[model samples]
Target: MTNLLHAMLGKGLGGLEQVFLDYQPILEAWAAKRGGRCVGVVRNGGKVAAAQAGRTPPLIPMPAFTDWDPITLGAARAVVRANRPAIILSHGQRPARVFAKAAPAGVIQAVCVHKPSFDVTPGTHYLCVGQHLANLALERGAAADHVHVVQNAVRPPPVQAQPFAREDGPVKIVAAGRLHAKKGFDVLIRAVGKLRAWDVDVTCEIAGEGAERADLEALIKTLDLDPCVKLVGWTDDIAGFLATGDLFAFPSHQEGFPLTLLEAMAVGLPVVATEIDGPVEILDEGVTGRLVPDDDPDRLAEALGELISDRDTAQRLGAAARELVLTEYGPDELARRLEAALDGMLVNSKA
Candidate 1:
């Protein structure tokens, strides 16, 4: 069987880390189908290691990786020598930086690009998490054939997304992601302030913790949205948290296939998102979900207000969105595409 290593020797949890952990076992299973096996490489006793605990194919936990450090370099080289994997799939920046050097003679090195700066070396292949990412990889000196579009995806929630239900009270709008300026949560808060003028009563809860938390709080006060807009910090239970809300709102300034957006869709919440790359690709206007111009609070507010007032249209869009995510971006489809990409890399390496 061909040996493969899925390396992400980084700290903390985010979209990149979460996708690696969730996709590891699926990648392993996919490899197994073709007479191969995939193993994880993570930081010893770190968040990634803990999350990937007790899964099949095991893992190789080493001290944190430093690209230029001789000790770290030697350790990486030693792992490559000992494992002698046919393919080394490194996730994000750190592993990408080192694996290009660590992977010796025969191993086919591939990097899973979660965002733009996560580049691979000339000969290495890239499994970009989004189509635009693949395009960017090509633009930034990667070989045309070396880039593959595997796309980002989310595993099916334990329970299906509950149906849209609002017996009383205002329409509940929910958003989840890092509270960064890039997420455009401030614009969402501004939009919440404008919803008042449309005579649409709504309560907005933005989940996740980031550096912008304090700034967002201040903005809420400035908008006089103290009663309706609240930045509810990060939570692990995104599915459960989303189930309680009436609508999902994503005002991200940029995204390379957001998994949380897919998660929100999978759970059947009518969504209104900014016209960013990922959202634009997946959401069809007035179909799956509503889309407003990015970084524009007035447009965001208008779209949110329109959906809130029309319950029938909101429910239709929610159901369609749920179907789109599950059918096109679910774990099963992700695995099939990932396997195909890896298979292509293996063939090219032989050639």
Candidate 2:
């Protein structure tokens, strides 16, 4: 029986925060079986914490931007001493730095890093989300044996039904994620304009909200994509939105285990995504989905056009994509993988 901690101080409920929140219930149940419990240290009044209200694996709110404050450090140290968790799993840059200072001797300190960072806390094991990220950790001076690659996982949608035969209409393309530049919504907008110029009837909706919303909206208007492309804002009913989409588009310039692609594919939505690492890993060339060059509007539009033209082929690909998610990326598989990694980390820490 051992206590476990998952500390996340991420500011908003982006992919990082979503993973943190989703894992709590699973981790809590994991510890419960061993007569222990899971605990979280999150930013005070943050969206993740607010969303975790009335949920299991209770939270301890921590002050923001006080990574080195004596009181903050002492408080975190006190929590560690009181909980005596066998493992401290910190997510995000700030949590890693803050907890490294508070972690006592004999505790296994591990960081689940999805993106590259130069920070390497001594004695901390890295659970990177991809080989690329694992390589980055090695370059950043992490111990070779201590770094482990654990890919992200997604739960299948609540229900799966084969898409119905479509009547002729504009192909509804749906893309989701924060409206940041890295998400490449501007590129996606341009792709839509290209599609229109090529006489491929299509409409697009981008879900999620961010600081880049204004810029994206301005670009949409400038391209005169009125009533054709839209920013749908952040959505809780992601599956429902995906259901309405005839095609899913992911145009990110970069990614590290993007949940958007998995979520879209899980619902049998034929995808057209940039040829980034995340999409490459999730999609099969000419099989489950279409892959286009990163940030290239023409290529993105071309791929979308192909799928839009061949409805039968697109449906077949969506079916294959759905099967891929069901067979390989289930939550059970993730839990098993995590158990093994945590066990290995514990053994190595004690050895």
Candidate 3:
């Protein structure tokens, strides 16, 4: 049996945590049924310590070094010795580089690559989050055979779609993710402000928390968006909050198979996202959602305004988005693919 470690690249909260945390139950259940144990691993134990202090029994605490120090490396090596894991699946570029250098020999190191990085080695097999990631890896000199595109999977919320009538004022849009610079919340706020100028009634609820919250709020205030935009903080009940919105807008500068986008699509919400690596792979532009240039607020606003004005068209797009999830992104199917990948890697290791 294999033991899985959800390693983090940084000490702070981010998408890697959200992606794995959201799917932790499904992965753990699958592993248990297969006689394997899956657990979360955080460096310095900040998140895990908080979780444990709250009496969250399921989250396991492992010694992790935040800055790739010798102590952290030694601790991770000790874990490899004690557990004798058939493979080490590490997320983010930093951990990927660390495990490649320090993990025990022949441990079948698998690095989950989601963004641009210059540190990866040829020996480490890359589990890319999407085709876009795979392409980027190959372009960066990673072995083609060593790269595998695995679309992220999340348990779809059991949603009962309620009919939403177009409001007289702004269209209710929800942008969910950690408030980071890369998330492009600044661009999104500007676009919303643009839409307001066009006299298109639109209100956006930006969810999740991070260091950028203050700056984002300041931008909203400067743009005079208090009446039209709301920065709703982190919530576990994202699905419930999304249910009240007419659309989802993610203007991230880059991503690797964003689970939030996948979740929104699963809930039958229309999206207006940037023409970035990850979104291009999942969203069928102009069909299920509209794709605007990376940082062009005007174009993004234009796309959103178009959908806002045409209720029937937006609903049709949203319905199609949900159908895409049912066909291409089922949880069970993802589990099967992961099982196959793990089995193949283990068998090849033996040979």
lDDT of each: 0.84, 0.83, 0.75
Which model, 2 or 3, shows the larger TM-score?
A: 2
Q: Give the candidates in order of lDDT, highest first.
A: 1, 2, 3
lDDT of 2: 0.83
Candidate 1 lDDT, 1-351, residue by residue in tens: 788888888777888788887778877886677687777888877887887687565678877646888877877888888877888888877887777778877778888887766654788899988888898888889998799998888767665544446577788899999988999999999998999766788899999999999999999998899999988888989998887788999999888889889999988999999898888878999999999998999999888888877888998999999888889988789888988898899889878
Clashes by residue pair, model 2: 208-233
Give the runs in model 3 whose Cα sits over 4 Å from its true position: 1-6, 22-40, 52-59, 66-68, 97-102, 160-163, 166-169
* Candidate 3: worst-modelled 10 consecutive residues by lDDT: 160-169
Better of 1 and 2 by TM-score: 2
Displacement of the residue 241 alpha carbon in candidate 2, Å? 0.5
Q: Positional deviation of 70 in candidate 3, in angstroms?
A: 3.4
State TM-scores per candidate.
Answer: 0.94, 0.95, 0.88
Please list the residue runs of candidate 1 whose C-alpha ends up more than 4 Å from where it truly belongs after superposition.
160-164
Q: Please say which candidate is ahead in TM-score: 1 or 3.
A: 1
Which parts of model 2 have CA positions greater than 4 angstroms off?
159-164
lDDT of 2 by residue, 1-351 (tens): 889988998778888887776667777877788788888888887987787776654688877677888867877887788888888898877777777888877778888887765478667898887778888888888888788877787888975534435577787899899878889989999999999999888899989999999998899899999889989888898888888888899999889888888899999989888888777877898899999998899899888888887888999999999999888877887777677777788779777
